[model samples]
Target: MKKELTADSAAAAARHARYGTLPERIRFEDMTEEVESAPGGAAASYDPEGSWKSYSCLALDLGL
Candidate 1:
């Protein structure tokens, strides 16, 4: 059989568990919602000066 409790009892149990228990913890405010998006578009997400020459290097090494 399942156990059931009234709202008052449930609240009391919750308060006891939250305050009357052995506990140590830390809490922080959520700052993600206040974050601002990047100033530029997707172009700013990458390094424009970066080069992709790894394939060429690998081909040269393998004599492909």
Candidate 2:
């Protein structure tokens, strides 16, 4: 049988990927450059919550 993916699991995966086993190692210096719209437009941001209580890549794609 195949297993289904859930939002909580996705969020955990994101957090883990950023911090790894040593969450304390997370540093702003290591973060990606802020996203901005155009050359001098407002910058984009990412939520540690992965954008919601349950992260949905589709929703994020639509700018939800």
Best model per TM-score: 2
Give each model a TM-score. 0.28, 0.30
Tens-digit lDDT track for model 2 on 1-64? 9777799988999999888885367678777687655863433554566657765598788989
Kindly list the per-residue Cα lDDT of model 1 for residues 1-63, writing each as its tens digit: 988999999999999988897655545554235767778977776764664643357677888
Model 1 scores a TM of: 0.28
Worst lDDT 10-window in candidate 2: 40-49
